[model samples]
Target: MDLMIANQKSLRNLTVLIIGAGPAGLSAAIQLERYGIDYIIIEKNKAGGLLLNAEKVVNYPGFPHGVKGTELAKLFTSQVQIRKIIKDEVIKTGYREKYFETRTKLSNYKSEYLIIASGTNPRNTNVIINKSAEKKVYYDVINLSHHKGKTFAISGSGDAAFDYALTLSKYNKVIIYNRADKIKCLKKLYDRALQDNNIKYVKNISVLKAFASGNGLALTLSNNNRIVVSYFVIAAGREPALDFINSDKELENLIKSNRLCIIGDVVNGIYRQVSIAAGQGIKAAMEIYYQLNKENN
Candidate 1:
């Protein structure tokens, strides 16, 4: 999709640059717009980030009946139209003189301050390396509807894993696995999973090995139990997707200098939510604004 920021001004001499156009970055952009700061956003993909794939967002405030993830994303994006955008993946970012220089696949850019809200990527498992196991592993439930007739095993106990299982169980049998007896998800989700006949919970275990079987994959558990399923979904967790910055020294320098601000899910934390990300974005923008204002004065 084209990057469009409403009521946008010129970016020829912008001071701030935000990487990523997710909830955090966009929230920062909206705050910056209100403050009349000249800035631009560099996004590699669509503006929604991980929120787009969410099945339903009931926890986010202001929606009494709950809202779909895509709908919320649309509402968030409509708030601000950025002055300029570089719709390419950032390859390297480092400090150059008084500005932070960012290199992309297409060109280079420089800004006085930088905000990184690049968000996350799916965690990887080596179970799918064999060609035979290609279509048997999945990281998301976006395509679960297609496998309505097949049984699946999900490897995780958090909200995502349970949510996926609950949704998938409506059409197919689902087995949810966790390494411990205690789950980290919301109590409501955990209770719902236990009550669903089509959804089974396998606790205090881990997947030791997996191999492709006839039209499915066979997984051997830590307890030495075997279960064969048509698909395996790993919701174990996610890792920060920050392969763009090539130099550790550059990141460290930015951290020490207070020139780099990391917002949203990319930051290390126990929880991740759209509202929190948006609040962080606003906080980052305010910090930058005050920092720049102090220097100008």
Candidate 2:
């Protein structure tokens, strides 16, 4: 068979292909499993996506007492274990007559329908901190519990920053820094941080410079005040995590064909919640199921 034919044949018999293993993608997989549909999920990194970085997930449904992001991710992952998951990255995507083809680092996959739940990546602050403190600076609050009881200066006043504070406050002192006077996080998170003696919120302050010392890191604020901390976590924001295609026309064609669906944080918006992403995934799967049924009839 030809190249195009070969690619399609390789992924033949699969009803749909889902990209990314985040809450959105896994949610899609769960729905497909319930329908007994043949589908596969491809992920470039770990299965949990950005949720793995979350220190705590307070708003996600079913957990009135709240749950850690890692725990919540594990729960979502467990439900989709029956579905096929390929640990690979999709480098490109294209559309052919009735199917869409995706090229990954390892192989090519094709399906009648596509669900893009790639999610987003943490936005870099572009602040140049001392290279020696590289190990002490983190973008997310993962695997840093061993440094408990130490002080942490978290940049950014978003939900992630507050959440990190709440998690770290269990054993560590946290200082949340915001460049502007207005806070971006939810009122609940802000109030919670206030109630916690371990968490301190500092606004209208900018980190001018960061220096690494033998003990930890020293940050110079815009006001020329220096504060030393054991670690620095930057939770500024996130940008879409999308792979590139050959050209805009190809992407436009795929989107125009109505077989390609973009969901989750990859769609790009202010709201980034596990529950929202999961709901979107279910909606996309249901739409695809109806479309397939109509076509089959």
- The worst-scoring run of ten residues by lDDT in candidate 2 lies at 1-10
Give the TM-score comparing model 2 with the true structure, all chains together.
Answer: 0.84
lDDT of 2 at 74: 91
What C-alpha lDDT values do all the predictions have?
0.79, 0.82
Residue-wise lDDT of candidate 2 within 1-297, one digit each (tens)?
012545445654467899889999999999988888889999977788878877778788789988888899899999996448889888777677677777778877768888989987778776678778787888777666556679999999888889888888889999999999999888988998999999999999977667798788988898879888998888888888774544466566566655777888888588778889999889888878887788899
In the range 13-83, model 1's lDDT, one tens digit per residue, is: 34888999889999999898889888888888777777775757897889988787778988888887844
Model 2 residue 118 CA deviation in Å: 1.1
Instruction: Output the TM-score of candidate 1.
Output: 0.78
Candidate 2, residue 82: lDDT: 41
Q: What shift in Å separates residue 70 of candidate 2 from its native position after superposition? A: 2.9
Model 1 residue 173 CA deviation (Å) reads 3.4
C-alpha displacement of 125 in model 2, angstroms? 2.3
lDDT of 1 at 278: 93
Best by TM-score: 2
